[model samples]
Target: MLEEIESSAHSSGVISMDNATRYLRPTGIDPIMGKVLNWLPKLGISIAGSRLLAVRGRKSGQWRTTMVNVLTAADGTRYLVAPRGHTQWVRNLRAAGEGELRLGRRTEHFTATELADADRVPLLRLYLEKWGWEVGRFFDGITKDATDAELAAVAPGFPVFRLA
Candidate 1:
């Protein structure tokens, strides 16, 4: 199992990468989709049960909000994943430590703990099993059936946060 990634950014607030260079394409249709989902929760609806995640930005000192999927495994652990990879919300949650998952009037307040790559195998599989239709394209065609080694090889690219 892998233990950690080579990232310079920690919950302690040292960041070496920015939005444009961190992931594949942080500014694209997905951001627009998130904006739409953020509005839906206000109207008491969701697409595939996604929620609006609102957290304080690490730099802006203001609420940075986006839509994210809350993954609940069979073991009952909850998680938030960045399928397109290291997004602003992921960075904010890392710096801020907690956030809220909202749908209309209902909100789930959570403290987030980012999981290291070596520890993400099973959860990655579960997430793909449940949300592949929505996020599979980001995985370079890797699916739930990908082996542990295969998943691990690409795990560093997907930032996962366990919420409590």
Candidate 2:
């Protein structure tokens, strides 16, 4: 199943690896590759917390599980960000506008809201601060203090979800 999705992305000509050099992620923080690399803990520690977000396919209505880095704010808002614009998980969230997240065996429903220009900046900043050093060119020209307009132009497809 995973291979198929990876294959499809390549076949569609939407996959780009040029940005990798500009961004840095500790070894496997790139979701563009696969979840196993980004999630599985090492030495009894996981650098980025992991979560399984389950959402129904927009076209098929079938539920799917995607491993993602979980980000939480001091204000109690939780978001799942896709630095890579061309990810299946991001697509699913957009198509459904709603999904459930699983941490271990616990599940919580969430409303998937596409973060506008105003929201992308902060989210991108958070992502960069956390994994940017590991990712390099992937985030070239992206700064922790980018304005909403800048984010909207650079990360047109990135989305931020609000937990319900």
Candidate 3:
């Protein structure tokens, strides 16, 4: 009984260590999952996947990178929409009005736009339907069929930057 208990403890310790890597590794997904995420954008897909964006800080003027969801517009332009109302990246873009999106190996310039609420109503509805739970609780009380006035109220906070 004593020998069996010692063996179980040793095996459990190894399992725990292996589990730690699951959280520590950034590309923790298997090759298949990684491939799926990489190809998602090519298929004209918007699968709630985010990429690291490097933008000049508003005050500091230093390079800052943060993960953001990618949203494509009708005119073949890509945008970074901030649904959270107030985030550091949104604030940075509002101040600097320019940034670069780092998607995998490519980086693209983008011009910021603090869209009016009425202007973003349609986009917001699409976001809620497509992004689903990935957008967090930001739009909880905000109705999908919000009026122009309601959209404008929230528009200042949810800025959209067009890729240049």
Best by TM-score: 1
Every candidate's lDDT: 0.78, 0.62, 0.60
True-vs-predicted CA distance for residue 13, candidate 1, Å: 25
Q: Superposing every Cα of model 1 onto the true structure, what RMSD results?
A: 7.4
Show how many residue pairs clash in every candidate, following the order shown: 1, 14, 2
User: Candidate 2: where is the Cα deviation over 4 Å?
Assistant: 1-47, 134-137, 145-152
- What TM-score, over all chains together, does every model reach? 0.82, 0.65, 0.60
Per-residue lDDT of candidate 3, residues 1-164 (tens digit): 96676566445332111211211112234335646664544443434556666678889999877666877667766667676545567668878888876665666777777665457766766666667466635554666666767755665556566656
Better of 1 and 3 by TM-score: 1
Deviation of model 2 at 14, angstroms: 4.4
Candidate 3: stretches off by over 4 Å: 1-49, 143-153
- For model 3 the TM-score comes to 0.60
Give the least accurate 10-residue stretch of model 3, judged by summed lDDT: 16-25
List, residue by residue over 40-70, the lDDT tens digit for candidate 2: 4322234477666688987888997766677
| Model 1: ten consecutive residues of lowest lDDT | 11-20
TM-score attained by model 2: 0.65
RMSD of each: 7.4, 7.6, 12.5
